[model samples]
Target: MLEFRDVDTFYGELHVLKAVNYKIEQGEIVCLLGGNACGKSTTMKTVLGVVQPKRGAVVLEGEDISRLSTAERVRRGIAPVPEARRLFPRMTVYENLMMGAYTRKDKAAIAEDLERVYELFPRVKERLAQSAGTLSGGEQQMVAMGRALMARPRLLCMDEPSMGLSPAYVEQVFEIIQEINRQGTTIFVVEQNANMALSIAHRGYVLQTGEVMLHGTASELLGNEWLQKVYLGQAEATPAPR
Candidate 1:
C-alpha cells in the first residue's frame, strides 16, 4: 500500500536515506531493521513526510505524495506512531484519543473506533479520564497506538514501538502489532527489536548508512548468517525457521 523508490534524503546537508526502494503491500507487515546510525528511522520519517526526499518518490497506493503535508497525508489514510510516544502529557487518555480524529467529521465513526481502540487496549479504557503523562512507558505506548488507530488508517507506520520498555512490555507491544496486522491494517515498522520484528513481519528490509542492505521474507532474513551475527550474536549458527 506504500512505495518508496530511489529515495534520497538529508538532514541539514548530512545525507541520509540514500536511494532506498521498497514496497509495503496491503494487509502485509514489513519491517526495516538496522544498527544505530543507520537510516531506518530516516526512511520512516521520509514516508511520514517529516523528512522530505531530495530525490525519488513516496507513493501511497497510486498517488505520488512526495510533497504532501503531513496532515494531508493523514487525511489520505496514513497514520504513524512515532519513535518516542508523542502524546499530550496533560490531556486525559480519552481526550488524547479524540485529538487523533480531529480531521474527521464523523462522530459516530470516531466513537466506534475509540471503542475498538479501548477493546484493543483495555488499560486505556480503564483509565480513560486519567492524565496521559501519568501512565507508565508501556501504557503511554498503548495510548500512542490507540491515538494513531483513531485515524482508521489504511497503512500504519510505527517507529520503535517497543523501545524504552522492559522485555515483557516489548513482547506485549509486538503482540498488539501482530493483532493489528491480522485485523487488516498494512504495517510498515522500523524497529531495533530484530527478534520481535522478524518474528512477526511478512517481509523485512535491512538498512545501513542510508541504504537498503537486505530485503527478503521474514524467515529468510531471520535465518540469514550476517543478520544473525549482527543482531543475534550467533555468527556461525545454521539458518532455522523462527
Candidate 2:
C-alpha cells in the first residue's frame, strides 16, 4: 500500500502540487484523473523520488520514503510503467526486461519472472529478439509494462498507460492491468482517460490545478453527473462527490 500525506511540491518558484493526498490499498487499482498540467505525472514522479517534496511524505506501507532515492524506491517495491513507454530503444525485448531486475540478486527468480511477463504479454514473447524501437506502439507499451513487472513491485505506478494507443489497444491495456491486479499487485495509475481508467479501477481521484477536487468508488464517480461533464464528457453536471 502507498499513501501521499499532505504533499506539497514545486518546480523552482512554481508550486505544482498543493497538499495532494491519496492512498492506494493493497490489491486495488486506483486511478488519478486530471487534465493536462493538473500535476498527475508530477505525483508519480514524487512517489518515485524523481522530484522530492518540499513538504509532507510519500509513505510505502508504513515507511516514509519522501527522502529516499529513486533507485531505493524501486528496490523498496515501487516500479513504474512510465507514460510514453520510455524503453531502451536499441535494447532487445528480452534485454529490456532484464534491466528491470537490476535491483534483485536472485538470477533464478529473475528468470522465473521473465517467463511470467511473457505469459502476461504474449506479444512480448513473440518479439523477444526484436529491437524495442522497432516494435509497434502497443507492443512497446507491453514491453514497458513487462519491464516494470520484472522488478516485482508491490505497488506498480503507471502514468498515462493509454496515451497514444488506439482505442482497441487501450482496452487491451486496461484488461491486462486488471489481470495484473487480480494476481495481487496493487496498481496506482495516473490516467487522462477517465472512462477507461475508472472502468477498471476500484477507486478514483479527480485532480484540478494540482488539488484533489473529488474522489470516490469507481461506480460513484462514473454516475456523478458533474464528473461526467468535467472529465467524462457527458452533457449534465451534477454535484461532485466529496
Candidate 3:
C-alpha cells in the first residue's frame, strides 16, 4: 500500500502538486484522474523518487519512502510502468524483461518469473527474440507491463497505461491490469481514460489543478451524473483530462 499525505512537488520552484493526498490500500486498484499538467504524473514521480517532494511524506506500507532513492524504492517493492512504455528499443523482448529483475540475486527465481511473465503476455513469449521497437503499440505496452512485473512489486504505480492506444488495446490493457490486481498486487494508476479507469478501479480520486476535488468508489464516480459530465465527457469541464 502507498499513501501520499499533503505532498507538494515542484518542477524548478514552480510548485505543481498542491498538498495532494491519497491512499492505495493493499490488493486494491485505485485510479487517480486529472487533466494534463495537473500534477498526476508528478505525484507518481515523487513516489518513485524521481522528483523530490518539497513537503509532506510519501509512505510505502508503513515506512517513509520520501527520501529513498529511486533504485532503493524499486528494491523496496515499488515498480512503475511509465506512460511511454519505457522499453529499450533495440533490446529483445526477453532481454527487456530480464533487465527488470537486475536488482534481484536469485537466478532461479528470475527464470521462474520470466516464465510467469511469458504466460501473462503470450505475445511477448512468441516474440522473445524480436526487438522491442518492432512490436505494435499494444504489444509494446504488454512488454512494458511484463517488464515491471518481472521486478515483483508489491505496489505497482502505472502512469497512464492506456494513453494513445486504440480502444480495443485499451480494453486489453485494462483487463490485464485487473487480472494483475486479482492476483494480489496493489495498483495505483493515473489515467485519462476515465470511463475505463472508473470501471476497473475499486476507488477513484479526481484531481484538478493539483488538488484532489473528488474521491469515491468507482461505481459512485461512474453513476454520478455530475461526474459523468465533468469526467466521462458528457459535457465540458474546466480543463482537458488530456
Which one is best on lDDT?
Answer: 2
Q: Pick the candidate with the highest TM-score.
A: 2
- Residues 62-113, candidate 1, lDDT per residue (tens digit)? 8999999999999999998988898999999999998888789998999899
Candidate 3 global CA lDDT score = 0.90
Residues 44-123 of candidate 3: C-alpha lDDT, one tens digit per residue: 89989999999999998889999999999999989989888989999999899988887889888888888888888888
lDDT of 2 at 166: 94
RMSD of each: 4.1, 4.2, 2.9
The worst-scoring run of ten residues by lDDT in candidate 2 lies at: 230-239
Q: Which structure is stronger by lDDT: 1 or 2? A: 2
TM-score of each: 0.95, 0.96, 0.95
C-alpha RMSD of candidate 1: 4.1
> Whose TM-score is higher: candidate 1's or candidate 2's?
2
Clashes of each: 1, 1, 0
Model 2 local distance difference test score: 0.94
Residues 95-158 of candidate 2 have per-residue lDDT tens digits of: 9999989899989999899989989999999999999999999999899999999999989999
Quickly count the clashes in candidate 1: 1
